[model samples]
Target chain A: MSSLEELAQRVAEGDLEAFGGIYESLLDPLYRYFYWNLSSREEAEDLTEEAFLRCLLHIGRFDARKASFRSWAFRIAHNLLVDHIRRGKGLRKEELDANREADEPPLGETVEEEAEKRALRQALEELPSSQRQVLVMKYFSGMSNAEVARALGKSEGAVNALRHRALRKLGTILESRGWR
Target chain B: MSGRKSKEIKAALAEDLLRRVESPKAPQRLQVYGLQRILARAAYETRTVERRWFRNPALWRRAVVLPLTALLLLAAGTSGVYAASMDAPPGSALYGCKIFFERARVALTVSRSSDARLEMEFCERRLRELQGLPESGEYRAWERWSREYRRNLEGVDSLLDALPAEESAGLAARFQAQLEEHHALMEGLLKITPAPYLPYLQQASRECMERLQRLRHRHGMEEEERGQPRGPREEEGTTPVGDTGSEVQDGAEESGPCFPSPSYPQAELEDLAPYGEDTAPSGMAWTSDAEDNWGSSPKESNGVMGEGSGHEGKGSANHYWK
Candidate 1:
C-alpha cells in the first residue's frame, strides 16, 4: 500500500502516532487552503484544527478508492470553510476592513501597480463563490484542475469553464480600472 | 501581442494576483495542539461504542451462540439418548431453541447485579455488538437479532424524540427509567442470579425456544421462518420489548445516573486529557522581535516553475495582512 494508505489504515486503527504524522504533513496545506478562503490568520488556524478534528471523527468512512487522503482532507476543510462562512462567527466584515486598512504600502511603488493589485483583490472578492473557488484552488493552492474538481465535487470541464469565466471577469475589471 | 499572447499575459496576471494573495500559516504549536485535541476526542468517542455495548446484554448473549452451540454439541456426544436427540440439524428450529436458552443463561449470569446502571450498561454493550454483525441469509439468528436490535434502536430514538428540545437537562432521569424497564424485561427473560432463580431463566429460555420451534415447525421450512410474514400493524408495535409509557414517564421524573457532559468547553481548547499532554499551540506565540505579532510567517513561496511569474519576487514578505 502507498504511504498515505498506510497512514489512513493506521488512523482507522486508532494509531495516534500515525495520526499525528499525517496531521503534521497535511496541516500546512490545509491551513493555506483555509487561510486563502477565509483570509484571516486566526480563523484559518481554528478552521484547520476543526477540519482535522472532523477528519479524525470520520476516519472510518474514508474510502481511498474514491479520492486520495489529501483530497478527502481538503473536502473536509472546504466544508468547514463553508460552515464558518455561514455562521459568520469569526472574521467576516472585520477581515475585509482589516485587509483594506493594511493595503497601505510602506515602500515606494507605482500607483498603477498598487491600484491593479487592489482592483484584482476586489474583483476576486466580487466573483461568484464558484468562480472564486476555482481561482483560489487553481492559483493560490496550486492544485490542478482535476484536483480542484474532485475537491469541489464538480466536473473538470466545469472547473475549466469557471476558471475561464473568472479570468475574463478579472480582465474586464482590470481593463475598466485602466490597469491593462 | 497576438490574442494567444494576451491570453498568456492574462494567465500570468492571474498567477501574479494569486501569488500576491498570501496563504496564512498556523502556529506550529496550534497544529500540534489541535491534532492532540482531535486524538483525545477520538479516544473519548471510542468509549461510546463501549457504552452502547453495556446498554444491551441480549446482544452479548447472542454473540456467544456459536461457541455455546459447539460446546453443547461436544457435550452431547458423551451424553444419553436425550442428549443425542438434542443435536438437531444445524439450522433447524431445535438448534435455534438451544442457542436461545444458552443466551438466556449467559444473560442471567452477567446481569445478576441490582444496579440498574450496570444492567443498562451491559445491555447497551451487548446491543452494540449485535448491531456490528453483517446481515446474511446463513446467519438466521443474526438476522432476527438484527431486526430486534433495529427495533430497539428505533424505540430509543422515538423515546428521545418525544422529549422537548430542552429536555437534555433532564436526560439522566429519562434514561434511568427507560433503562430500568429494559432491565426488568430482560430480567424477566433471564432469572439466573439467585441460586433458586437459575431454573426460571432456563425455563424462560426453554419456553422461548419451544415457541420458536413451534413457529418454525408450523412453517415447515427455515426460509419461511426467515421471511415470516408481518401483519399490517406489526411495525407499530415494534418498539423495544421494554419501553412502556410509565417507564418513560418515571424516567422523566427521577434523575438517572449523571453522565459526563458531551460538550467540550472552548476554554479547554488545549487540554487533550487522558491521551497525553496538550501539545497544541495557543494562538499567541513569543517571537524574537520586540513586537508581539500573533501571526506566524507565511512559508517562502517557490513560484510554480516554468509558470510565468506575475508578482515581483520579494523574499521575507509577511502573508497576513496585519
Candidate 2:
C-alpha cells in the first residue's frame, strides 16, 4: 500500500498520531490549491485547516477501494472551494488569475520564465473545472497520470488527453498574449 | 515553436507553476493549533464511538468487541463517568465532557439543518445547567454557567442566521416555544430566588427570548424574500424589518400552548433551594418533568422529543431539535 493509504488506515483505526504524518504530507498542495483560487494567504490557511478538520472527523467512513487518501482529501478541498465560492466568498473569474502573475517573481527564474509561468497559471484557471482538476492533481499535488485518473474516476488515456489539451490551450493563450 | 521545443517549454512551465503554488509557507502557529484542535476532537470522538458500540448489541457483528470481562470492566469504569458527566454542572469534574460532546456533535453533523438543531439544543442544555447551578448555592458555578449560557445563545443566533429558510423556520418556532416555557418557569422562580441572583437569571432568560424572536423575524423575512408565505405563527401586521429586535409577547401571539402546569410539586422544588431557609434552589424550578417535553414537535402526540418520531434520521425540517 502507498504511504497515504497506510496512514489513512491507521487513522481510521483510531491512531491519532498518524494524522500528523498525513497533515504534513498533504498541507502544502492543499494550501496551494486554496491559495490559487482565493488569492489570499490567510483565507487559504483557514480553509486548509478546515479541510483537515473535516478529514479527521469523517476519516472513519473512508473506503480505500473507492479512491486513494490523497484524492479523498483533495475532493474535500475541492468541495470546500466550491462551497466557499458559492457563498460569494470567491473573487470573480477575471480577478482570480489576473493578479497571481503580478506578484513578485520566483527567486531564480528570469523575467521571461516568470511571465510564462504566470500565463500558464492563468490558462489553467480559465479551463473547465474538469480539465483544471486533472492538471492540478497531476502537477500540483504530484499525482501520476494513473493516480490522477483514479482520483478523477477517469481512464489513463482520458487523463493524457486532458493534459495534452490543457498544454495546447496554455500555449495558444501564451501566443495570443505575445509570449514565445 | 517546434514540437520538441514546445514539449520542453511545457514541461518547464509546469514545473514553474507548481513551484509558484507551493512557495507561500503557512506559519507554524496556525499549523500547530489546527492539529491540536483536531487531535483533541479525535480523542473525544473515538471515546464516544467506543462507548456507543458497547451499548449497541446489534453492532456486535461489525464492531471490535472486547472480551466479556474487559468489556464489563471498561463499561463499569467509563459509562459511570460518562453518565454522571452528562448531568454534571459547570464546576464539576466531568463537565468537560459536556462541552466536548457539544463540540463533537457540531463537528460530526454533516447536514446544515441538523447542525442548526444541535446548536439550538446545546443552548437549551446550557440554560438548563444555568438554572441548576444556583441550586447548589455555589455563586461561582452560577457565574460560570451564566457565561456559558450567553456564549451558547450567541452560537444559536449565528446558527440561525446561517441556516436556510425552511430549517430556520422550524428551529425558530421550536426555540420560541421553549423560550416561552422557560420564561414562565423563571417568572415562578423569580418570586423565591435570592435577591442577588435574580437579575442575572432574569436577564439571561430575557436575552435568550429576544434573540429567538429576532431569529424568527429574520427567518420570516427570508421566506418572504423567497416568495414563500410567512409561517402560521407570525402576527399579520408586524413585518420583520431588518434588525428591529422586536419583542415577542407570550399570549396568543405564539402558535402553541404557552405554559403548561408544572409537572413536579412546588414543595419538591422548594426543598432544593440554595439560599432561603424555606425555599428551594432556582435550578429545581426549571427541571420539572414538563420541561422535558419542550423539545417534542407540536404534531407528535407521543411527546417523545424527536426519537423514532419518523423525523429522527431523515433530514426533515420538522425534526424540532435533533
Candidate 3:
C-alpha cells in the first residue's frame, strides 16, 4: 500500500502516533499554502488551524482511489479558505493593503534592488483567485503544471494559459511601475 | 546595453525579485495547539457516533448483524412494516409505540429539544404500554434491552471520562454531559419499558389469532421472527416521527419561543419576503454580479486585476530563460 493509504488506515484505526507522523509531514506545507494565499502571518495561522480542524471532522470520507491523501487534504484546506473568505472572517481589508505596501521597494538603494520583488508580490495579490491559485501552486509550492491542474481540477491547458496570462499581467504591472 | 544584454539583465532582476518573496511560518505553539485540538475534536466525533449507535437499539442490531442480513431484510419487504405501523390511528397503542420509537431515534440523532420533545409524549405513553406486557417474553426482552441500555450509558460515561476531570461544572461542558446522560436513559427505558410487549404476548397467547397471519405476513412480525420481544418497530420508509405533519406544525410554532428564530423582528422578515430571499444578512457579499462581469471581460481594469499580472516583468523573463 502507498504511504498515504497506510497513514489513512492508521488514522481510521485511531492510532494517534501515526496521525502525529502525518501531522508532522504535512503541517509545514499546509501552513505555507495558507500563508501564501492569505499573505498575513496571524490570519494564516488561524486559517491553517481551521483547515486541520475540518480535516479531522471529515477524514473518514476520504477515498484513496479518487485522489492522494495530500491532494484531498489540500483540497479541503482550499475549500475552507474559500469559505473563510466568504464568511469575511480572515485577514481584514486593511491588513491586505498594509501587506501590499510593505512589499514595495524601500526609498533608496534597497528600494531599487528589491523593486522587482515588491512589484511581483503586489501584482500577485491583485490577480483573481483562480489565477492566484494557479500561480501559487506552480511557482510557490514548486508543483509541476500537471500536479497543479490536478489539484485545482482544471485542464492542464487551462492551467498553462492561466500561468501564461498571469505572467504577462505581472510583467505589465512591473513595466508600469518602471521595474523593468 | 545590447538587446540581448538588456534581456539578460531583466531576467536576472526577475529571478532576484522572485527569490526575495518569503514564506510565512505559523507560531510553534499554534501548530502544536491546533494539532491537539484536532485530535480532541476527532475523539469527540467518534464518541458521538458511538453514542448514537448504542442509543438506537435498531441501529445497534443492524451494526451487530452481518451486512448481508441487513440487505436481505431490506429486500425482503419488511421495510414497509415500520411505515405502515406508524400510520396507525393517532393515540392508538401502535401509534403511541411508533412515536416512542421515533423519539428514541431523534433523541439519538438530533440535538434540538423542541424537535426532541414533539414525539416525547408519545414515547412516554408507549413506555406506559410496555409495562403491561405478559411475563413470558419479559426476560428475553429485558436482556436484549439491558445490553444496549448499558452500552449507550457506558458510551456516555466514556465520553465524560475522556474529558479532563477538572471541568466538571462549566455550563457548556456540563450541558453536553447532561444531554448525553438524558438521552442514554431515555433510550434505555424505551428498550425495556415492557408495555409494548403486550401486543407481542397477545399475539403469542392467542394461538388461534392466526398461524395464517404469522405465515402469510411473517415479514411483518420481525420482532417475533428474531424471537426478540415485541415492541414498536419503526415503520419502514415512514417519515421519521420527528417529521410528522403535526410535529412540523408544532415545530413551526415552538420554533418562535424555544430558540431565537432566524426570523427575529417579524416586520423585517416580511419586508424582505418580496425579495424572494431570507432577509437576514448571512454576511457574504453577493458576488454573482462581479463574477459574471469578470468572466466575460478579460480586460485589465487597473493595477493587476487581470489573470496574469506582473509575471512578464523580470520574473517571467528569468523563468523563461531558466
By DockQ, the best candidate is 1
What lDDT does each candidate get?
Answer: 0.51, 0.62, 0.49
Which residue segments of model 2 deviate by more than 4 Å? A91-117, B1-31, B40-322
Residues B74-143, model 2: lDDT tens digits: 8797767777788989867678777776777788989777776877787778767756754554444555
Candidate 2 TM-score to native = 0.39
lDDT of model 3, residue B244: 15
Candidate ranking (lDDT, best to worst): 2, 1, 3
lDDT, candidate 1, B1-322, per-residue tens = 5876776677566666666645444566675578777777767776665556444465556666667887898777535433443443323455445444434444565322222233334335434433333221122333344333333333333443454544422443444344444344434433212211112222222222222222222223333457866543322332122322211121211132111111212222122111111111121121222133313321111222123221221211121112
Cα deviation of B313 in candidate 2 (Å)?
A: 65
Q: Write the per-residue lDDT of candidate 3 for residues A54-129, one digit (tens) a residue.
A: 6666767878788777777777777878887788765465777687566433345455445544456666677788
Relative to the true structure, candidate 3 reaches a TM of 0.41
Deviating ranges (above 4 Å) for candidate 1: A89-91, A99-121, A174-180, B1-8, B20-22, B48-322
Chain A TM-scores, one per candidate? 0.79, 0.80, 0.79
Order the candidate numbers by DockQ, best to worst: 1, 3, 2
